[model samples]
Target: MIDYQSGYILRPVNQVFIYFSLFCALMLNLLPIDNYSWVPDWLIICIVFWNIHQHRHVSVILAFGLGLLMDVHNSELLGLHGFSYSLVAYLAISWHRRILPLGLLTQALHLLPLFLMVSLFPVLTHWILSGEMYWSALSAALQALIEALLWPLATVILLAPQRRPIHVDHNRPI
Candidate 1:
């Protein structure tokens, strides 16, 4: 392939794997830990990654539903996560082609803003509505920075199953 991601050809990603990964990420996010601003939203990050790599399987509706589930689980305002997640999905899906061809760290840098938006949008909206604004800017930045820094690692792990070669036929042409 003229523009392959790596030396080995990635296998066709199964729908089941995509959903299972997303589910695992969701479960991780749902753990009852004290809400920390520095903690990255794994669900949103996974959703964004899947949106970029497997948009056909992972769509905005899925993101919206996942966000709503998170909102309910966290006992926060309704539709806040839903709206932000869907927005991120739309942005990812629309720009995925451009993003896919870039280097890993550059991809992280490009996506940093999207992560920041997801981190801050709900908090900012809630603050504005309830009129209790605080220093969320720093927290959102921290969360986004952490997530962005992990993007390359996330990609490596997530893509491993697809990248592993089933058979190496030296005689066969790629």
Candidate 2:
């Protein structure tokens, strides 16, 4: 079990895990999906997980930085994703104590629309700013649908309890 002492930064291994997860999310975001990308935003999902699990350790500022990096990588309007992600992070952090203790199914169900709402706000902003009201609202709705569906799986996989290691004498090997 990891002992997170008060105000202690994450251990090296944990830091690496966080960085790796974020990097994977970035790669997923950058994946070429042709003209129509059906993928949900992986980084947001990871951010949600981290904030839920360790809000004290990770803050809205981290989410903002990641979101800004994502926008720069994708060449989207600067600060757009940053603002949206920071908002989401704040929501998650504020609700962390309440939400993190719930059962997985309940948590997922509860957070589905919350995630959708966060995602939709940015999309709406993007659409209005770009003056490209071309895509129907259904398109954004569908993306949120996919994201909602994936959230439970993401939480389970990322936060699943790992088996503990056992000690055995080498001489006892069969």
Candidate 3:
């Protein structure tokens, strides 16, 4: 169990698990799902989850690096995902303390705007550059909606190890 009064202390192994999860999410995001491809923003979801729960471990630089990698993988305009993800990381870290005390549903509600910002920033940038709004922006909004709906499940899966009961050797000397 975590010592809440002293703050959560993550072991080295836990840190590796978190990064490994993010890698898996990146691979999952790269899958070819046809029209349903936009249904899940796996990388953004993972980044947001970690930033909120373990902000000290997940930094905005890491988020920006992952976003750059995502842009390369998707053949998108470079720096688009980087900027959006960094923004999401910043917002998540900013609001984490307030959101931490809320129920899962309420937390998801609060994150909706952040997720929308993450999804729409690239589209808005493109519109500004081209002077035309693409209908594809609607898909980003739908993706945000899906992500918000799935936030609770993501939290449960990602944070499960942290919530596990720790075995203390009481016989050991203090």
Better of 2 and 3 by TM-score: 3
- Angstrom error at residue 143, model 1: 0.7
| Cα RMSD, model 3 | 3.4
lDDT of 1 at 47: 97
Q: In model 3, which residue pairs have backbone atoms overlapping below 3 Å?
A: 1-166
Candidate 2 TM-score to native: 0.76
Tens-digit lDDT track of model 1 for 1-174: 112456666778988999999999999998888788777899988999999988989999999999999999988799999999999999999999999889899999999999999888977887889898787455777888999999998998888777756677788775
Cα lDDT, all candidates: 0.88, 0.70, 0.84
- Which regions of candidate 1 are displaced past 4 Å? 1-7, 136-138, 164-167, 170-174
Which ten residues in a row are the worst by lDDT in model 1?
A: 1-10
Off by over 4 Å in 3: 1-13, 35-38, 165-174
Comparing candidate 1 with candidate 3, which one achieves the higher lDDT?
1
Cα lDDT for residue 73, model 1?
A: 94
Q: What is the per-residue lDDT of model 2 for residues 1-117, given as tens digits with 9 covering 90 to 100?
A: 231222222222365666677779878877776424366888888888888776766789989998898778768789988988898889888887777556666777777776787
TM-score ranking from best to worst? 1, 3, 2
lDDT of 3 by residue, 1-29 (tens): 23243345443338888899999999988
TM-score of 1: 0.91
